[model samples]
Target: MTKRIRRLTAALLAAALLAGCGGSDSGSNTASYDAVAEESLALASGGTESALLPDTATGESAQKIIYRADLYMESTDFDAAQDTLLDAVDAAGAWLEYSYQSGSAKEQDRRVEYTVRVPVENYSAFLEQAGQAGSVLNLSENAEDVTSEYIDVDARITSLEAQRDRLNELAAQAETTADLLEIENQLSNVQYQLESYTQQMRALEGKITYSTVDISLEEVAVLTPTGVTFGARLADAFGGGWRMFVDFVQGLVLTLVYLWPLLVIAAVVVGVVLVQRRKHPRPPKPPKPGKKAPAPPAQYGLPDAPAANAPPQSGKPDAPKNPDAPQDAPAAPAETPEPPKPKY
Candidate 1:
């Protein structure tokens, strides 16, 4: 009976060992299979695939294109051309995002710049219509394909949204205050990213839906020649030179107009200076070289007459007079000689 019990126990031990080994192997296989299945499922659903991958089921996704155009044009009749351009815009169902008009009819440099937004469907038609409004000086177009970028942004948005939902669930099931707070923080971050990505997506959509066109319309006296011939070039050169001369004259006139106040002030100053000079005349200058100076005038006065009470003078010497007799005759005294008459 003891031997039988031992045999039974060994059998049971061997069976238990075999069962344990088999169970471990099965568990490993199941684990590997589950891993492979998860990977296959992820690939089938495109969950782990690159966002830039082209869609296979739909053949290919529609291209996301952002179109922009720049047009520089000139027109002789500015007002009429402007009217035409506006009509075209209205016809195309486009709106002017920005518009600026400068220079006036008097200036002869009337210019209008328009930043127009047109529906993508009307982009080509609008360009054709706008070109008709004026002579095209320059035209440029750009088409940007944003398919990959669009897909990337969209995928990121979807991921962030899913993460937000998961975080919300986690927050609700959180056991501890700290855990709940952490999940809420993650949730907030996910929400913020989602909002940012959504905004970006909307902006991109707007750009794709509505193409932008920048138009510059300038008033010109002559249309630019489209030909590359020498004659055309010569004509253009002549026209440009003439226009330059006219512009210079116009600029000078405008400058004078703007400085009229200063001109008036300067004129007043000059007039005042002239009047002051006239009021205060300068002294006469010296005689010129080789010219004689005027002589002084002679003075006129009466000549001195002979002294009064003088003896009579003769040509011959006086004879010796008797002292006594002479005294008696001298007493009568010589007649006073008359003074010489004054000359006029």
Candidate 2:
């Protein structure tokens, strides 16, 4: 009887050991390197082997793509063109995402920049229309294929959700506080990952649904396509000249601003020269001759002045008179005596 009892005990112990080995071999382990195996483990732990995920893997998950464009253009009338573009956007069922306007030279030029979001169906047509809003100086288009990345994210979210469910199950079964706390920490991490992935997916979907376009509008004093109305022409005729003059003045000021260094050098050189001049002064110049002395008082009465070209003298070789000969009336006494006798 004792031997039979021992044999029964040994058989029972062997059966129990075989059952434990079989269970360990058949059970799914989340720690497995294979992703599918890990997911199976999680499903087992969560007791939700048939749990369903959202319809991300269906038609809703088309080839994920991001579309964008950049447009630089000139407008005839800034305000009018902007209004026209806005109206067109409404017509096309697009929305203005944002806008900005600034000036490189407020007096000369300004720039208007904006971002618009349009349905993918209307994206190309909207670009064409917006391009016509003005003379397109620049047009650029871009495309990004994110299908692979999106798939990756979606799979990650699904896995994380499964993990969270399994962790929740573990938490419920946890006997000790430490075990519960560890499970909660893992749940938190999984939840965080799920949230981040969901946000990214939403953003990507938004981009796919509505293509983005960045536009830059420029306002310039000239080269606009606006018509020349009589009034506008007249105003422009005058205003153009005025603006040109203003530009000239502005350019002059800018030139001065830029050339200040040259001007300063010139000024210093001039100052140095002036200082040197003051230190060593120049001598005064001598006076100049005024006029020739008047001709010697008319020669003592000659009956008449000789002509410059008159023949020199009658051929008589007269004797030269002495320079000391008396010039006073000669022999006046002899003549007076004769005249007194004739009168008596």
The superposed Cα distance between candidate 2 and the true structure at residue 221, in angstroms, equals 5.2
Q: Which candidate leads in lDDT?
A: 1
Question: In angstroms, how far off is 311's CA in candidate 2?
Answer: 89
Task: Compose the digit string of candidate 1's lDDT tens values, residues 267-338.
Answer: 999999999999999998989999998876656795655689888677798788776663433356568989
lDDT of each: 0.70, 0.65
Model 2 stretches with alpha carbons more than 4 Å out: 1-61, 103-108, 221-344
TM-score of each: 0.53, 0.49
Clashes of 1: 0
Pairs with steric clashes in candidate 1? none
Write down the TM-score for model 1. Answer: 0.53
Q: Candidate 2 lDDT, tens digit per residue, 1-344?
A: 33332332233223222222211121122112123433443343353432422223323446878899999877656777677678778978999899887655545456688899999889888988887777776789999987766665555556556556655765677667765665576567667767877787788789989999999887655553445468766875786598678778989999999999999999999999999999999887545678665565776667776899998888789899898998767664554444455563
Local distance difference test, candidate 2: 0.65
